[model samples]
Target: MHYNLRHYRAEAERHSHADFHQIIISDVGKLELEVEGRAGEVCGRRMAFVEAGRSHAFRAEGLNRFLVLDVNIDLAHKTGIEALWQSRGRASAYLELQNGAQGSLLGLLDRRWFRSDASEFTGDGMPFTNAIGDPGLVDQIRLILGHSRQAVGTEKKTGSDIPTRLVRVMDWAETRLTEDIAISDMARIAAQSESTLFAAFQRYLGTSPMRWLTAKRLQMAWFLLQDCQIQLSIGDLANAVGFSDQSAFSRAFSRQFGRTPITVRRDARKLLGAKL
Candidate 1:
């Protein structure tokens, strides 16, 4: 039941945790959310529950802070948290907080819940075990999340420091991403043999260097499309991000962001209308 404060940039992201469920409540601006095939936005006291191990993605604009809690599945039933789920791990829920639910959740926002005191609610003294005995705080959780057909639901922090050598490669890739760069170029930049570079990338980033570069190129293209001022034509934009064929670039961009360049730019225009 440890809580965390997270900030998501406007850039789109897609990933998942295999061992824990995630509860996200927006504290500031809206967060575009797509979890396990359903899509919604979290804001205005709205919250979402993403069951353990489901693939999800999110994006946001302007300033935003989200209150995040990572829940262990085993603790769910034990803590009486599963009262909200409609169908266990396969289905997720999104709802607006009601009653004193918002207050109950926000009360736990004290920074101490995230640090050493995190253990204050586990084991025989388990938050759930204790919660069942006293029933005050856990009851509040059930009240808020148990709404029919609605609403929502930290942990072993994953990932390690990106190896220092790979950092050099990434920095070099960003500046020349528009240029025709290859794995050899990246390996040379890091002064590592191609095989070694491959190992490091697979071990750290879970992808090959060239694939990572292509993703980076597409991400850059996406950023450009979001900006109101960068008005390059689709073909020119494709070449600018190192894609030789405009059609191929469009397909890749669509695959990455689920929207064609034309569509993203059009949406950006609508959003930027007031600012411009």
Candidate 2:
């Protein structure tokens, strides 16, 4: 993972990343982001997500501070954070973190990522190491993942049975991410009643079935966007991801990833070049 502290005074030219996922957390002042063709503003303590190869630009209203993290795509996948990554595509343009969690995260970045004497720092009893190798990077990734999951209301599984049942439901939903999935569908797949399924999801995932399905579809769309081999128009991609209208798909995409489909495609083209 790569980290940077940005203090912005002017607008940045439109740019894209080829192989890194970006997390931009607003710390001070106001910042406006233009991704694809859409624009959104970040104020206060909020974070924005930009998938690899997505085109985006930024401008500041005044002095703006940002904590940015750029994580390798493959390492992200290897961290058992597929669920977080899948649902991340559905995050709003800027997500507000709880005060305690926000402070803790910022403090961690300050003490560990920015400071040279980070060797003295310990997080949850794990010794801090220079962010130079995969081990240290992966540890930092887990820290971010843990905090992000908590920030997004992802709950830890309390019971083994709940996870087993939820896994069955998730597996069924994953295969049909592009289909219109209902609570009944999940219930049937899990061999449980609708209420039982709902309870299981609530206990293990802390969300409803349809909401999870929507997240799954968004994740599928994100996955498709990253595949240079798949030549698809935004409308086609929307339809492929079970969205009936392009506008709705665009809205959902922007809400999830803080970037537009056009932006994603543009960045993908730049990253893949001839392959795309």
lDDT of each: 0.64, 0.60
What is candidate 1's lDDT per residue for 150-252, written digit by digit as tens?
Answer: 5444111122688767866775465455567778888997899999999999989899998888887887677656755544689976876778899999999
lDDT of 1: 0.64
Please give the distance, in angstroms, between residue 106's alpha carbon in candidate 2 and its true position after superposition. 0.9
- Residue 154 error, candidate 2, Å: 23
How many backbone clashes are present in model 1?
Answer: 3
Task: Please list the residue runs of candidate 1 whose C-alpha ends up more than 4 Å from where it truly belongs after superposition.
Answer: 87-92, 99-101, 110-140, 146-276
Give RMSD (Å) of candidate 1 vs. truth: 18.4
Q: What TM-score against the true fold does each predicted structure earn?
A: 0.42, 0.44
Worst 10 residues of 1 by lDDT: 122-131
With a 3 Å backbone cut-off (N, CA, C), the pairs that clash in candidate 1 are 70-154, 94-151, 95-151
Model 2: CA > 4 A from native: 88-93, 116-130, 134-276
**Model 2, residue 126: what's the lDDT?**
30
